[model samples]
Structures are given as structure tokens and as C-alpha cells.
Target chain A: MDPAKLLDILGNENRRKIIQLLANRPCYVSEISSRLGVGPKAIISHLGLLEQAGLIECSVDEQRRKYFNIANNMRLEVSVSPYSYTVTLHDVTFDRGKNEEDPVEKEIPPGEESSTLFLKLSSRLKELKKRQEELAQMQQQLQVEYTEAMDHCLDSIEEIARNPVECELLFELLKNETTLATLCYNLRLHPSIVNANLIGLTKRGFIEYGIKNNQYYWKIRETGVENE
Target chain B: MDPAKLLDILGNENRRKIIQLLANRPCYVSEISSRLGVGPKAIISHLGLLEQAGLIECSVDEQRRKYFNIANNMRLEVSVSPYSYTVTLHDVTFDRGKNEEDPVEKEIPPGEESSTLFLKLSSRLKELKKRQEELAQMQQQLQVEYTEAMDHCLDSIEEIARNPVECELLFELLKNETTLATLCYNLRLHPSIVNANLIGLTKRGFIEYGIKNNQYYWKIRETGVENE
Candidate 1:
């Protein structure tokens, strides 16, 4: 699987929120939408992208209502150094879909680091194959949680990008700092429209206003790239 | 470090190429530029992103030219199953920077699989703490080549994206299928310009032309996302 594409898809804050919710327990589109306070259409779009990336999967229930959850027994581990990085996708054959409950919530026995966890799992792998499979299943779920937490920082600026006017304003700000008056004039937009865009952008961490030459100038924030 | 950000940065084809080249051995900017046949400015931009993501570090040598190499003892493993994934970053402390020569060039012993490799490393961790550290350092370097090989499928499409005309044409094609003649007319560009962009995009696996309604139409390839 393409880790970069997967990263890009899950980079969305809403999508990550969806994953977090599903990682806790399976939820359908409307439930996820209501819980996250996002539109159902947007949630479905996010789910489609996640499914295309193979990050999540949907299963239909008896009433034919689709439930979304993380794909079972999927684990991604990425190790990086200065010169190189490794991505390994383990398709551990764990029956997590039916038997496991809140697979990602497996608590680490306090004070246990990954090495101990590895040893514990390794020992299990050495025992009867069936027992080994069970332990790998648990490890797989634990790993899913670990990966999601690691990527929580990559929450995307996609929501801001959904608004063309606001996105354009942010991009313009990224080029150079300008006063609201100057921006309104330059973009041929009315003062009120520009002000609204600026307000929205600022609230979303896209732009910041500061005094320059004793006048307020809006400049794009460093995290502006988080926007699509 | 933000694994998602790191993944996003490395998602670029040029950056991955830089990593692949450096993994073979450290190379200066000009040398890497020549090897990849890309312009110096683009290589520099790619390098800057990699360094910012902490995937690489640079050192200045005698004569003041900067050389780039992967950071020592950094390992990333990503495992994916249908349901979940895990990313583990290991900052193994070993003085392999001095003792190890061409660390990524370590050859696997004949008939050894990754499971054996893991088993061997796991057992070593069960030994004395110092011995475990030594084994981990070796494992860290050994993992370098393994990861590079694993991501071989994620080849870069960055070259196609470097050209605005080509990139725009590819994006346009993604919208719908259109014959070259129609695209030239609609996009208000000459046939030669459209054809050149088409060829560049096609060579990079960005688009494909096929006969529809007895006329050849261009459609964006699925791999278009591989471009930066």
C-alpha cells in the first residue's frame, strides 16, 4: 500500500476523527456524522477516501445498514532514520472482526514498553501456532491504535479548503502580508467579504494578523499547508 | 516526530529518489542532481523537505561543500492488514556511524526470511542489556536495506509534476476523457503544446489515450496521485 497516499487521506482532521471513533467501536455514516458534527455527505466522502486507501472497511448488517470499522488485522509500522525509512504492512491473520472488542483499546500493563511487548508476543509465537495467532491478533489491534496516535499531529486543513473564497484568501495571504484594505482592493473583493474570509481563515489557524509599519497586515501562518 | 508529516514529505517522488540515492552512499547535491538528472533547484527543495522531516541530515566537509546521508540508526516499520496499521520509529542508539561501513549494504544470510530475522533479534533482546543494545544497533542498520527494498513499488512521479503545463494538463485530463484535438481547442492551447504535455504525462504513467466514439481520447491514469 502507498503510505504517502494513506497518510494524505487520513491527514484530514475529520477523517482521523472518524478513524478514532471507529477504532473505539464500529459506527455507520449518520452516527459518525452526528457524533463528529460533520455533514453526512462529508463523512461519506471521507469514508470513501479512507476505503480507497484501504484504511477502513464497511460491512452491511442484517437490516442492510452499512457499519464502518478499521480493517481487521491490518498493521503498518514505519521506522525512519536520517538516511532511510522502512514501511512494513503485516496482514496478520487475526479474527479480530468478530471476536475482538475494542481491539485498539488494549491497555499496556503499566510500565511495559514495546520491547517487553515484543518479548511477550515472541514467546507466544514460539508456543502452539493457535496461541501465537491469538497474540498476533491482539498485537495487530494495539498497533492500529499506535499508528493512529502517531499520525494525530498530521490533522489536515481540508475543512478550510472546502470553502473556495476562504481558501483563496489564505493562499493570497501566504504570498505576502497585506492589510485588509489592501487585500480587498487587490482581490477586487468588497471590504465586508474580505473581512469575513479573513475572520474565518484566522479562526482556522490559516492566517495571523500583526502590526507592520503600524498597520495591521495579515500573513499566512506556518501551518497554512495543513489546508488542502 | 510527526510520522504523517514525515510520510507526506517522503511521498514526493524526488524526495524518495534522494533517499534511495543517499541510502546507497552519501552524495553531495550536485552529484545527486546529476545522478537523478533533475535540476539543482528542485533537488535542493526536495532535500530541504527531507531534512525538515528529519529523514536526513547534512554535514559540511572540507572545502565547504555539503554532503547528505540518512541519519544513523533510524528505523521505521509500517505493517498493514485489512483492518488496521501500525507505525514504529526506533531511535536505536549505536555508534554504527563510526563502526558500520555502508550499513545498508549488509547482505542477508542465505535462506533467511524476515521471521527468522525477527526471532534472532528478539532472542538477543533476552540476553544481557548491553548485548541487546548491540544486537538492536545491528538490527537497525539491517532494517535500512529491507525498507528501501520494500518501498520499491512507490516510485516517484515528481518529474511530471515539476512542469506546470504538464501537471495542469494531467489534472485536466482527470476530469473527463477528451480527444487531443478537442483538448487543444477547449483549453485554448496549440496541438503541439497539448501533445507535448500528453507525452510527458503518458511517459510518467499519468494519462492514457484510447479510442472512444472512433476518436482517440485522453484519460488520466489512476497513478496520477503518485506525482508530488
Candidate 2:
């Protein structure tokens, strides 16, 4: 799904509340309306949009009453740091056929007591939760390290870059290796100015360029200074 | 920051593009406009909102040119599945005071070669990236386990619950232990109807209630069935 579209769908407070409510259990329009303390008409409209976006679905009961529930397993992750901004959406659907040896699939035995199954499942969930928390902590630590390193890189570039264009050239190169034409286009700078900065950066040992397909592609040197 | 507010800010493609641009390098208003192929007036407005939300900050250079850059280190995570929907915003700031023993902070010696420092930082970042990928895979597996367990729980409740209200009651109980008043409020059902469903569920051994602070709190029984 497009991150912008997903963000737009979730931007409304009522829509977010509806998703939260349905996350716990499926509900019909009236139940959702009353539970959310919103008008039924508004809830219906939100439901329509949610269903269209494939974020939710409806099932009809024997009485012809419709129940709405979450339809997809997905995650949206947005990270904004000094060094990078990224939005990633993952479709996390389970492929049971591919994971035939997964222990979770074989945990429940046929005709087993539902109570014991519940206990086992709940315990497994608790363990997963603990591990997730630990992973989250580790991820946080990594973010800190990333931010610190980027800050240091910026500081070093500030010392080496002689002008604003040179600064921008080095910063862009820090992200990835790219040719001069692409750099000019991305930075909205003239080709001559970008080329001059790239040459200067290479002389200062701040950046280097290699030939690919008969075009020069520039990138930040892993070891920033030369003759150290 | 509020998740809804964050979503609203990121919903605009231009604003998202602006952030993506700044993630590479800070840019002043005119530079941003030219790079994005947007008019200065509209870009300024977008920049204003971003600044107001504290997502971007501007610094004025000696030439009085204002450059905008990312202001915060944060992450927004939204998960949607059959059993849960959650939106969490994390402020991933570096608490240098708290993490005094962190090797990352101590690795860069003052006045050392910037080239060697950059190399070390880059290698450390690569290692962190590898670890993060491993953790992400583990997290995906955990989400699968959670969804499967919740599905199993729902199936068990369907077998035991005799009516819509009973099913709703059990679903609500599956989330956490709550009192009758809270359940009535959350479900938006009549007090008598909620009480009846709770009592029936308790009798059928699907749920159990305990007295706390002179009020009855109900929850799904770990062992769902009454008999072994």
C-alpha cells in the first residue's frame, strides 16, 4: 500500500478509533457507532473507505447481519532521524504451506481440551511479548548509535566542505554512490558546479568517484581523509 | 507526538518529499522549492507546518539564509492484524547521561584521525544493520504467533458463546480483566444484558470474576473449561 494513502486513512481520529475497536473483535455498523459514540452514518462512511482500502472486510452472519473486522496483517514503520527518513510497509501474511515445520502450527492437537490449548497459547504469547520488548530495546540502542555516527559525519564534512554546494555534494554522496548527472538533478545544481565540488571533495579525500558505463559515479570515501 | 497528528502531517506527499530531501541534506526554502519543483509560497507553508509540529527546524547562516533539517529522532510504528491494531510513537533520543558505559560513545577519541573514526563508525553501523535485520525477522515470527493464538482463542469462544452479547463479552474479556460497569460502557450495552452475559460466561467456565476494591472484575479464565 502507498504510505501516503495509508497515512491519510489513519489520519482521522474516528477512523483510527474504529480500527482500534475492530482490532479487539469484529463488529457491525451499529455496534461500532454506539461504541465510538459517533453517528452511524459517519461510521458507515469510514467503514466503506476502510473496506475499499483492503484494511478491513465484512462477513455476513446467518441473520444477514454484517460484521466488520480487520482483513490484513501488515505493519507500517516510519523512522525520522537526522541521518535518514524512511517509510516502509510490510505485508506480514502467514504462509502456512511454506513453513510446514513451524512448531506453532503443530502445537494444538485435534480433540485436545480447549482449556489446555488456551493455557499453552497464552504462555507462548507471553514469551513472544518478552522477546519483542527486548528486541525493541536493542533497536532503540541501534538508533542512538546511528544518530551519533551521522552527527559525527556531518561535523567532519562541515570542516572539509569549502562552500554550500560542496557541503551539499558531500552530504548527497554520503547517502549513496551516484553519477554527476543524477547529483545535479537531485540537488538542482548546475552540472559544472556539481563537478567542481566533486573534484574538490576528491582532492580533500572527502569523496571518490569510479567509472560505470562510461560515466563517473561519486561516493563518500569510507576512510574520509587521505595520507593519514 | 500524537499518532493522528503525525499521520496528518505525513499524509501530504509534498511534505513527505520534503522530509526525504532533508534527510539527505539540509536545504533553504528556495533550494527546496527548486529541487522539489514546487513554488516557494507552497513550500514555505509546508515548512511552516513541519516546523510547528517540531518535525523540522531551521538554522540561519551568516548570509541570512535559512536551512531546514530534520529536528527529531523518532519512530512511528503501526501494526494491523486480525487480532490487534496498535499505533506507537517512540522518542528515540540519545540519553548520554544514562548510558555512560556505552562503547559507541567512547569509541571516537578526541583529536584522532577523522578518517579512521569514519571507518569505525561505518563498520559499527553495518553491524547494527545486520542485527536489526535479524531482530526484524524475529519480530515478524512473533506477530504470526500472536495472530494464530488470537484466532484460536476466537474459535474457542465461538464454540462456548451462545449469543452475540456472550461473544462480545468474551472478546472484551480476552483483552483484559474489567468490571461490569466498564464492560457495559465499552460495549455500550444495557447493564442487565452485560451482567447476564458475564454471569453466563462465568457459569460455563469461559471466564472468571474476582472482587477487588468492592467491585467484581472479570477476565477470561486461563484454563477455559471447568473440567479436566
Q: Total clashing residue pairs per candidate?
A: 37, 0
lDDT of 2 at A80: 92
The DockQ figures for the candidates are 0.08, 0.46
User: TM-score, chain A, per candidate?
Assistant: 0.39, 0.84
Output the number of the DockQ-best candidate: 2
Q: CAPRI verdict on model 1?
A: incorrect
Tens-digit lDDT string for candidate 1 (B1-228): 565565565556677678867764578999889878999999998898878766678999999999998764444444443222344544454444342353432453432232233223322322322342343343333233222221121112222355766645643453346788877765568999889888876765556778878889887553323321
Candidate number with greatest TM-score = 2
Candidate 2 runs further than 4 Å off:
A33-45, A95-112, A160-166, A192-217, A221-228, B37-41, B95-112, B160-166, B192-217, B221-228
Recovered fraction of real interface contacts per model: 0.21, 0.59
Instruction: Give per-residue CA lDDT, model 2, range B197-222, as digits (tens).
Output: 77776776667878888888887676
Model 2: number of backbone collisions: 0
The DockQ score of candidate 1 comes to: 0.08
Give each model a TM-score.
Answer: 0.39, 0.81
Write one digit per residue (lDDT tens) for candidate 2, span A1-228.
776788888878889899998887789999889878999999999999999988999999999999999987888878898778878777776663444565754665645465556545555565666786786677777777777766666666575567999877867776667988889888778998888878776776667778888887887666545563
